[model samples]
Target: MNEQISLSAIKNGNINAFEELFRSLYPPLCGYALKILNDSDLAEEIVQEVFYQLWKKKEDLLITSSLNSYLYKAVYNRSLHLVEHKQVENKYANHVLNDNSEIYSIQDAMQAGEIYQIYKKTLSQLPHRCRKIFQMNRDFGLKYNEIAIKLSISVKTVEADMGKALKAFRHSLAEYK
Candidate 1:
């Protein structure tokens, strides 16, 4: 297909033209992306996303260069962005793992254990419904509305129980603060 004619037809919302462009370019684009990304699945995904964006923005599409060059550039840019993102994630993970070793001492572990014991004791002293509400919110990560629905109580009741539980814990753990 002539590059200019196909681009024109694509701009005019011709699905056949778009499909033809996609079918012809997809493999080469994926191959180009794979050279940068080093992952077949991610390369395919990048190419697909580029095509999707092209189709989605077809009405405003403008090609100042060859369509092949444009598609290759898009795939290349996206692949590099993904690689940079992964590098950032890996750096963050490494920083956390390396930094935490120095930050936490044996004394910190002992203090944490003592705090946990105090927490458990304080929790046990709470009224049955208040303890349940507090556990639902904290341990189970349930929202107030979810806890209220599960316990067949009003949101106000859940709030009151949580407040009471928090007060008991604060009073019990005051020495640590």
Candidate 2:
């Protein structure tokens, strides 16, 4: 199948070899991704990211078997990771909604206040940057780009801090529930 030729050429830093491989596998990869993810757009994203990673990691990449299995496994694992992360976010969002609903009752309101107070207290214990970023997101309603610009940090950093903030919130608020 000349698989060794392609892999060897790519290992020697042949751009043409990588491009050829990408073009040849693009359709089947997207089709496989679609079968796994059930969404055309997501499938395209997964396939694209898979190829990009292959290119980025070309130097240390060692494929003892067919490259197809390696690529397929990488895409599958990435999709599963994405799904698991979404599930966690959804679970926490549902919990926050439930807490908000319970705040309607008078007795629950006092209990909720205590819960919120405890949450605020714990939040204050976070590093200054983390606290500021969390407040900007929850209290100021700023997007990641805005927060990044305001704090002179990268957008990726802002996104990361928001993730950390959510994790901390979930941990601290667990005491209430």
Which candidate number has the best TM-score? 1
lDDT of 2 by residue, 1-177 (tens): 377898888878899988877776666666654544456788789879998888888889989876756775676566555555553233343443335334223334334434655676678887789889989988999988999999999999988877887888788888677
The all-Cα superposition gives candidate 2 an RMSD in Å to the true structure of: 20.4
Scanning candidate 1 in windows of ten residues, the lowest lDDT window is 101-110
Clashes of each: 0, 0
lDDT of 1 by residue, 1-177 (tens): 788999889989999999988876676677666655567888899899999999999889788987767776677667667766664233343443445344323334334445666777788889999999999999999999999899999999999998899889889899885
Residue-level error in angstroms, candidate 2, position 143? 51
Off by over 4 Å in 1: 87-177
Instruction: Give stretches of model 2 more than 4 Å off.
Output: 87-177
How much is 106 displaced in model 2, in angstroms? 56
